[model samples]
Target: MEELLEKLLQAVEFGKVDFKSPYPPQLKGENGAYELTIKALESGVGPQQILENALVPAMDRVGKKFSENKIFVPQMLMSAKAMGASMLQLKPFFTSGEIKTKGTFIIGTVKGDLHDIGKNLVAMMVEGAGWTVIDLGVDVPSARYIEAVNNNPGAIVALSALLTTTMVNMGEIVSDIKANLPTTKVFIGGAPVNNDYCQKIGADFYAPDPQGVVEHLSKLAS
Candidate 1:
């Protein structure tokens, strides 16, 4: 059991999507995350066990590597893709209530920010860490963010803005969420957003990178 889970973990960390994917020359022709995860489930391993023991730990390594500059966005995105392939097999368990997630994370690019690459990366990384992600896409308004938080109680909100101009929208969203959904935690991120900007807007957290976001959410989970 441990050996199989380790395969899944390595597959995720190394960006191995499946047997046919050949991007990682060293892992060529090996069963990737998708096949390995399916095998684990078919062998009677618990889905939650696979997630907690395999997927989360693998992403933790990826996150740490990213934070340390050992890897960049492309590598992290590939890892996220590999993790997502495994998640495809595990998702049904979540829907059936056979497994549970850490929590729901609502994320989006604040209004006037059409750039979704950063937001999407954060969404995928956070989702691979076992949270249910609700992506509101680009150019999302404050009203829409409030609606999502209102509908999903206890869900944490993350606001992203790639441009200095759109950054004002993040503050607006944070303000609206804090004013209306007082209990919900609001996290802000972007190139133009710093801890000072986060504090000024009354946001709960400020993570400069995807790993920091994952770490912050991990604390909330505990």
Candidate 2:
């Protein structure tokens, strides 16, 4: 079981989706996250063990490498894809209540932003960390975010914007969310977003990269 979990971890970390995926040349033809995860389950490894031992640690390392500038968007995306493949095998366990999630996360790109790469990365990373993710997609308005919060009570909200003009919308959205649901915590990010801007907009947190969001969620969950 340890060997299988180790292989699964390496597969997800190196972006190997399956035996057929050849993106990471050195891992070509090896059983990737998809197959390895299935195998682990079939061999009677618990779902939570796979998530905590393999998926979380793999994404954590990937996130740290990304934060350190050792890995760029392409590599990060590929690692996310690999992690996603493993998650698919574990979904049934999640739905069956055998594997529990940390909490819920609601994320989106603010209105007029129309950028989703950063939002998507954060969503994937948070989901990989064992949280239920509700992605609102790009160009999300305050109403959409509020509605999602209403639907998923106690969910942490995350907003992303790539443009300065669109990022201004974050302040209004944050204000609206606070007014509507004062207990809700809001997180913001993007190229133009900074710590000071986050405070100015009344958001709870601001992360320059997706990894920061994952780390914040971990601290909250812990």
For each candidate, the alpha-carbon lDDT, in order, equals: 0.91, 0.92
lDDT by residue (tens digit), candidate 2, 147-222: 9999999999999999989989999999999999999999999999899999998999999877889989999999
Provide the lDDT at 31 for model 2.
95
Q: What is the lDDT of residue 210 in candidate 2?
A: 79
Tell me model 1's lDDT, rounded to 2 decimals: 0.91
lDDT of 2: 0.92
Ten-residue segment with the worst summed lDDT in candidate 2? 71-80
Residue 216 of model 1 has an lDDT of: 89
TM-scores for candidates 1 onward, in order? 0.95, 0.94
Candidate 1 residue spans exceeding 4 A from truth: none
For all candidates, the clash counts are 0, 0
| lDDT, candidate 1, 32-54, per-residue tens | 99999999998999999999999
Top of the candidates by lDDT: 2
Q: What ranges in model 2 sit over 4 Å off? A: none
- What's the CA RMSD of model 2 in angstroms? 1.5
